[model samples]
Every structure is written in C-alpha cells, then in structure tokens.
Target: MSGLMQKEYERVKLHATVMNTLFRKEPSDSESPRLARGQRKTRESFDARSVLKHFKDYEFGSLTIPNIHLSQRFSTGQDLYYQCVAMAALPKS
Candidate 1:
C-alpha cells in the first residue's frame, strides 16, 4: 500500500508539472499571473496530524486521534468515515 501511494503521488506531481508547462499561458506584459489558492496549498507543507482525527473517527466511539485535538461532536460514525475518505482522496506529496 505504501508503494502504491508513493507511485500515485509521483504520478500526480509529474502530471501537474507537465500540465502546467504544456497548457499554462504566460501573462501579458501588463498582467501578472498568480497561483490559485489550491495550488498554493499544494505547495505548502501538509500536516497529516491536523487531519488525523478525522480518520480516527472511523473507529467506534472514538472522539479523537492521539495527537489531534477534538473540537465537536460527530453526528454519526459514517460522517467521520466520509471525512476520512475525503482526506484520503487528497493528493499526497
């Protein structure tokens, strides 16, 4: 699983770079292009700890992961499960 994830991460990084190089247009002399918020976030360091609690909510009656702070009640375990899934769906770099 780790190997698979590493491959996927590399694939996405390469694809992003290629797409940026091939399709991104240069700004006109009067304009400057800025990276989108999502692009900027992608470049920022990812703190897995910040999001880890969402994953632990998958366990029965668990309110928090070891290192993450608990903030609110989760209405149902499934809700937390989906949150974990969403986090997992994000590109890892």
Candidate 2:
C-alpha cells in the first residue's frame, strides 16, 4: 500500500469511529450528573435533526470505500448492521 492509500485507510477508520460514536453509544445515565432540562432538550432536538439529516442522505448499499479492503466492506449488510446499532443508540426528541 502507498502513502495515499494508507492515509485513506486511516481516514475511513476514523470516519467509522466517529460515526459509531455519534450513532452507536447510548447516553448513559450512570455518567456525570444531569444536564439542565433545557440543555437536555436541546441535545435531543439536535440529535433528532442529525438523525433526520442522515436518513435523508442515506444510501445503504454497495460502496467503493477507498482504502479499506475487506472484500465485503461496503456500508451494507454487515455494515448496515453496525450502522443500525449506532442509530438505535441515538437519542430521540
């Protein structure tokens, strides 16, 4: 692999990490103290909007991921499985 491909692979991994973080993790109640009600509401609203935006631009099928080479690496099938896991963990408004 060349430097550019390695960079692209890293980028994709980072993108996957961020997407997983944004959509996968639940807002844990056992974490730090609560936010103000207004703040909580604001976060919920923002998350809802983000989710909607994602859905609007959604295309869950074959993809040409630049660097990651796993044969079945498109954001579909198993990839969909992970994305759904993330989206399911997203907050509702």
Candidates in order, TM-scores: namely 0.18, 0.16
lDDT per residue as tens, model 2, 1-93: 432222334344433433333233355856857667445222222356767777896876885443343322324455544222121133333
Model 2 global lDDT (CA atoms, 0 to 1): 0.42
Q: Over 4 Å off in model 1, which ranges?
A: 1-42, 59-93
The digit string of per-residue lDDT tens for model 1 on 1-93 reads 543222333333211121223233546624866667445322233356766777766765634323322122222254442122112233333
Q: After superposition, how far is residue 27 of candidate 1 from its true place, in Å?
A: 19
Q: Which pairs clash in model 1?
A: none
TM for candidate 2 is: 0.16
What is the Cα-based lDDT of residue 55 in candidate 2? 88
